[model samples]
Target: MSIDFLKKYFFGDVQSSSDVSSVAFQQSALRILLALTLCIFLVSEVHFLFTAGDYSFLAINSVYLAALIGLLYLSRRYEKATAILFLFTLVTASILLLTLSNEFHAEKYALISLYSLPLITRLLFTFKASIVAMVANLYPFYLITNNSWMGSAEFLDSANLLTSADALAGASIAPSFYFQMLTFVTLNIGLPLAVSRIIQTLESHAIKMKDLNQKLNSHYAMYEEFFENTGTPSLLCDQRGKVLKANQLCRHLLTGGIKKSLAHSNITDWLTPAGENSRFAWQSDMAECTLKSDSQTHINIRRASLTEHGHLVIHLENTTELKAIQQELESTQETNSRLAHFDVLTRLPNHRHFCQQVNQRLAEHDKHVTGAMFIIRISQFKLLNKQYGKDNANKVILSFAKTLTHKLSDQAVVGRLRGVKFSCFIPLSQTYLIQKNLSELIKSILPKQITVEGNKLNMEYQVGIAYYHTDGKNAEALLERCEMALEYSNSVERFSFYNNNLENKLIEEHTLGLSLSSAIKNKHITIWLQPQVNASGDICSFEALARWQHNGQYIPPPQFISIAENLGLLPLLAENLVRALVETLTDWQKEHIHTPIAFNLAGQELMNDGFFAFLMALVTDKPWLKDRLELEITETSPVMTHPLVHKRLRSLSQYGYSIAIDDFGTGQASLGQLVDIPANILKIDRRFVFPLPHDQRHVDIVKSTIQLAKSLDMKVIAEGIETKEQATLLIAMGCNTLQGYYYGKPSPMTDWTSHSNAKAKTLRMVY
Candidate 1:
């Protein structure tokens, strides 16, 4: 091994200054002490063999040398155990060597070696272990001093003989021996203890310095890494604005590339000041500066002190792209603000914006400044859309908006309130004049023969006006009053003003709606059946009709039905009516009556899938009820055009419930709708049937309707047969079923049962 390797192996690896008192240090110190002891033993053995020709001292040294070698070998494997074992060996070997030396007349050398034991143990081990080793080593010396073993001849003779003749010739050896022994004890034990304490204090200071140096190195490494790897451009400069050190990013940003050293270069030479005072400052604490480059690029430079000696750190950030992005963000915000206040299609104030403006004006206006709000509703707009399509309809609406904007630009604020509806706020004094002007503008801008997409269309509108503070105080209230006035206006009436009478009627309608909703829930609405008879005058089926009586006065069907529909309570009313019909049918079933009863369904009821599903669930277990049930729907119901409603109707038909189209001729159902609808029976409207046999036009229409129904495989039943003549005419016209006052008016189930029994008895008598 190399000298360095050997040193490391025998002692320890080079320890940091901070680790001088660590376990490795202690072990290295112990190993060195043991090595020195081995060298001393070798020197003593050679000296004794050459000068005194005594092999005993050499043998003692040999035994100790072997133990030291073993301790050294063990030190590499188990340092702590080896250290303790070495201390014990030192104490034990000292006692053995002292005894052997006394036997060989070498008491002086033995006493010297024994005195070193406590010092070696204390230096290498704990104070307690050293004390125990010192006591153990003193046992031999105690025996020699007390003459405990001198009674033996061998010990007495060895003790009497001295290594030097001068000591042996002395008259009394005790005093001289005592002086030499005391001197040896002081030098060996006291010197080692004092020296060891000094070494320990020095090691403590070394450790503190090593720790401080390591901490400094760590901090420096962190700063170096941050300087080189930080994404931002950085430079370390002196007070003169000269670059002392720069990171890679700083080089690339300032000089394009690191082709040459940037050391001691004046930083201000490459940058122009953004302000009028374009001079570089020599003194700096912390400041932000804007600098422009040769390529017209803008840079933000932050200069801050890095050291007490006026060294500064400069950070560079490019602001060109950031400024562009900020500009784009501001532009986007502006566009969004505009969109929030104006309609995207017409670029006019929208409903929310219009309401805000009106509210602001109302808050600012005095009581003397009376203003009026006008809501212009485009009539037949839905029909126009249906005919010309949405694209052209939008074009027409846009044209109307443009006309309003142009005509009322100076006099009022105009806005598109909602679909096909526009609003204008103008002075109440000029209301009449504005209305007249608008009428003329409407006539001129929206002509009767206006052509769009090669199709001529007639445009019409209705205008409703509500005066501010008189009709309402806020925008919402004014708008609601305008809508109410518009609703009350007729097709012929182009404009109307808000009035108190309309509000009273609305209150009455709302009151009626509440009453109807309660009546439906309480099952006060009763079912009345109108019988439909065959040509033989035999009652075949009864059509179910809903009748409501409140406080002994019957409410008309049209009024209550309209009220129910508007209140969104039509489904509840329909369900209660169906329940009554089913109960009546169940009674008939119990009496063995197989007659099917038809119930009317409104358009809204037909659209409710839940209603049909409820009916199916109610009669799911009663196959007889399903067989005897019939559903009658008006032909004009908008639900008939819906594919989902049509599917549900077909499903009901498949479930064995008869489906009928009532008042067929009164509705505007297309031929295709009539064909596609799943109906087993078609009831000709009473309008045509009431004038039957008298007007040939009515007669011809009924006959043609019956022929159409027959061709479609549907049974034709003529309704409103109030006379035998009408029934006879319908029977002759291929209509086998008739329903009207001629047979029986709609009556309660009990009354209908009595009339049906009476009719049955009369028919029996005739047969």
Candidate 2:
């Protein structure tokens, strides 16, 4: 149990009683005192107890010796052990002072233990505490040495036990001995003061030096953070260009997203040979150099050395794009000069260049050699331009130029003369004239139709021929002869050679145009109704077409319409067509037949104030006309997009008139037009409908148009559906309205029965 107690007492979490600063002094004093008490004072106590026959003191000394062994520890954790040892020694000394050291009698070891209390306290505690110990010990010490305070017989006995004959020799700490011990006190106190002064100076220096080192470390840490976060492409390297540390941008610029180790990498690896050579010779503290990288990029590099033999910071600025921009400015004028000789619309040679080259060819030809000049003119081009707008007209001209160039050989001269006309000069090289055999070649070129904005147009043209050396000498004279031939072709409506009888053909055309104006005034213009059917073969509506049979000859609609536009008779034609349409629908109404009829309206007819008022007044009183009337504005109307024209159409639509875009998918038609215009029906043009179920591109166009109409809550009608297969494919693609000649051709109103078609609705607009 004692061994267990000693083990726990020395090794457990014990607390120290002394102050933190004096703990080392307290422990050292306890160790030295414990050793001496056991070696000298403890041994002397045992001898004195035996000699004085003091068995009580001997028993107490035996227990103290037993406790001293257990209280001692070898480890440095001796705070609690030191406190317990000091307290135990003071308790033992007190016990001896109270029991053995009295006024009458005292034991010798007890007197020695009490006198040593001052010395132990001075070593273990502060000097003030030791002075209090000495004050307390003074009374007990005096009691042991007081000779008269004890009886003479007892005093003599105590003196005889200690081998002292005189009373002064009875105690070891005598008055005379204290006086002598005081003589050496000055040396002991002076030596401790001298050593304490030296220790104070050393501790003060250590504190200041420790603070200085902490401040230096803080400044270095801030410097490192600033170096790593520098914004430029900076690097820390030796003067020889061996990289130690580089900022993030510098690493990424050199390595291009690859994570390469920093060890032994040099800036010279990415430089060109010239740049690498320049870097080796660089010596200034700061220098600017233009370095070319291996990637062929120019870099304006600026470098500065941070130290005499360590680290260089470099910044790279790219100058490749700037240099290229400077070079482009030098060549701009040459490009402009070359472009000046070509036509802007078609990029073909202009009239000036064409004439100059043709005159040169005439100069080169021998007197026997011959070449022919052919001038080609697009028919009704004025109407074509008015119907489809200038942008689409430009597309047609450009397409014509490309097709003409593709058909002819490279040596043949082809050029755009001016608006809707082109010239080609083919020279004859042999006795057989190529000009006489060139009609078949011209026929082949004519069949290659021009497609403008997805609508394919027939390339109908009239070509006038004039032979060089037979007609005139140079380009100007040959062109004049060609123009005369062109005038004859315009009147006769066929390709013509140089002729002198051009006025007779013009007289005949003039007679026919006069007959057309009389037909409009005399109400000779008539309309025929063609049925538009749905996918189920049920009739939806009828398209009203203008027809004329004058002088027992059938004039095509396109031929007469172009003549009417030139004569300014479109409004008069529109008035006649509307009257015929009402008559047809009124006759059908009396027969109990009802179906909607639509007709084309040109932009010129809609914008005429007098005609617009007449049409609106006719439908204003007849409220039932809303169910039977539908107005179809031609998609190729020249002024269809004008604000006043759109206003008129929208007013008609607001009055419950069914409106549709006629001949759609041509001439600037787009998805945006369908959304913005106030129309309910999008009629697909015949060009797209004619190629359906065969041409994949046209099929996709029809399919997408149907989907777009359905998405916008509009009905889609596809015309020119000639085959049942085409109708079935359109129905499968989500279109229900279909119309074409496969259903029916345009016929008289009396031809349709009351049961087969209940009612025919009329929507007439003059085109």
Candidate 3:
């Protein structure tokens, strides 16, 4: 077994012992004494039985040796009990040997064994046990020496005790022997106990020192790692500002300085005057300072005391990058502020800035003081952009702004309000002179033309003026009035002034637009059908036109139609008209009349896929109505070029519905453009059809249009056939259909129903 296991088995868990070292020392002493006792007894037994032929003394020595061996075995299980037993055994052996020496007259051997008992007992047991064993062993010596005890004892008389010459000699020397024995007892017990205590104290002190040394080593390692690996530059300094130690980061920071190593260097040499003064207090919890080295490098220093002995720990953190970032952020903020107030392209104040300036000026105005604002808009600017591209177009606008600003310097404040529109604010006193000057400036600039990429481009402008205190009292009101005047100005007139009539007209138009949604919802919009006739004068179909009547007065179609388009209500209006016409056709079907009805599709309605889907869904269950339905499209519709419009028209035509191009001649569409449109009929404009046979120009135009329709394999329908002569001329010109007053004026479905029935009957009779 291992030594630790053996110690635990003999000592019964040394940690549980009050003092482990003391217990270990006592155990070692007990084993050594026990072995010595056994050896001494064995030698004595051999001498007595073999050399002297003494059986009694030999048997006693054998018993003593066996007891010592038993003690050795018992010590493993019960150390304290075995220790007491060993001490008792030592005392018993001494007493027995002494008694035997008296019985056998071998006093010299007995005295020698008894003399070592005190030293062995004191080393093995505690003080009290050692003293008690010594006293008990002394009683045997007293009994051997005292004659009275021998006489009183009956066993002593029967034992035949003899007094040899050696015994007499021992008795005569007993006084001096007792003195020496007493001195030996005192020295062995007291000296061994004192030495054991001293040894225990030394062991305890050594253990504590070892533990303290381990703790110090662990702390030192942690401190070393922290100082060397930390990113912040650090240093240790004394009370006099002398540097004691510096970490790796601190050494790197001071590499290029006058003193390469910070150790033993005065800290004041590196710090500014303010920093050195701040450190004079030394007791401050924390202080910040700046360090400018001899190399001109800047360092931010943070210092604090590490110990009460006036030791300071300094940390350095570089802030150069942080300062640079702050400067960059400030620059970006300035740029953003500039962008917010001024236009980046033209370098003029933006619309918002202009509005703010105008409001500020108006707030500073006194009563009776007046100012004028002009909104100058470029004419055909979109066309110019398309011709020269956006870059050259912007150049022209920039040139115009620069020239205008130079001409009106100090007389007005000008700003670009929006694309192709510039706004100017000036005192009313200078309005006439500024206006004349602007007119002259534009005239001179137009003739010279704006040169962009070596190309000369001509531009035109129109101006609208609104005077404050007369047109408006605020910036928004003035700008709105100026826009109305600009829209109402004639093309020939380059400028116009805001008047009360234009404002009143705008209010009326706005009011009409607001009521249009309710009119459509209430079904006040009705369809008026104009009949179309073939060459034989038989009615073929009727064209459905939208009519509105409100409060017993009929509103003109042109006025309300434009209003509806501007208000983005064209889809709703077209759907209402289509529903009315479908209902009228349904009624005609119930009356056994199956005439196709054509309805106009607005530009916005054609582009709206949702409305087209709604129309298709309405006729899904009434598939037969597709054959009697015709959709007419204006050639000038902006949505005509849209892909969705082309897709819907083709889808409708594939579903057996006829598509017709209305007012074909007046629109800008050419024959090539019409070729892609899925149209079955081309309607000749009313202007060409109205003058009929008498106006040869009109006659030739209609004839040529009819010929064009024939070439495209499309039927030509002549509109505005007011007279029989007009109808006759259209038919002779090879027009397939005639639609106008010659057939029947546009009337409600009820009036057209009766007229259509009479015409059908008359045509049947003629046939």
Highest-scoring model, lDDT:
1
Clashing pairs for model 3 are none
* Model with the higher lDDT, candidate 2 or 3: 3
Candidate 1 has its poorest 10 consecutive residues by lDDT at 758-767
Tens digit of lDDT per residue, candidate 1, span 649-713?
Answer: 88888888888888887676557668777888998888888776889998888888899989989
Please tell me which predicted candidate would have the highest TM-score against the true structure. Answer: 1
lDDT of candidate 1 at residue 15, scale 0 to 100:
55
Estimate, for each residue in 1-767, the C-alpha lDDT of model 3 and write its tens digit: 69887566544464564444556767777766666777877787777876866677667778777888888887666778787787667657655655554553444445545555655666666657556655655665565555533443434444444334354344565775587457555554555567557665767786786677678888999998888888788888876778888887777666643447676787666654345556562234444444545433445666754777768887766555665777798979977887898787788888888888888887777767777887888887898899889987898889878877876647467888889899888766554445566455445533246677887776667878788878888777888899998987767987877899988999988888778878877767888878888999888888888888876888898888888888888888888778777776776666566778888886689777777887787668678788678889887767677777878888887877788998887765557548667898898888877676888887777778788889879988888888888777777778888888778888877665475555434443222
Tell me the spans in candidate 2 whose CA falls farther than 4 Å from its real position. 1-511, 587-592, 641-643, 753-767
User: What are the RMSD figures for all models against the true structure?
Assistant: 8.0, 20.3, 10.8
Least accurate stretch of 10 residues (summed lDDT) in model 2?
A: 758-767
Model 2 quality (TM-score): 0.38
Candidate 2 structure quality by residue, lDDT tens digits, 381-460: 78779989988888788778887888877666777888888888877655425555655656676545777778878767
Show how many residue pairs clash in every candidate, following the order shown.
0, 10, 0
Candidate 3 global Cα RMSD? 10.8
Q: Itemize residue pairs with steric clashes in candidate 1.
A: none
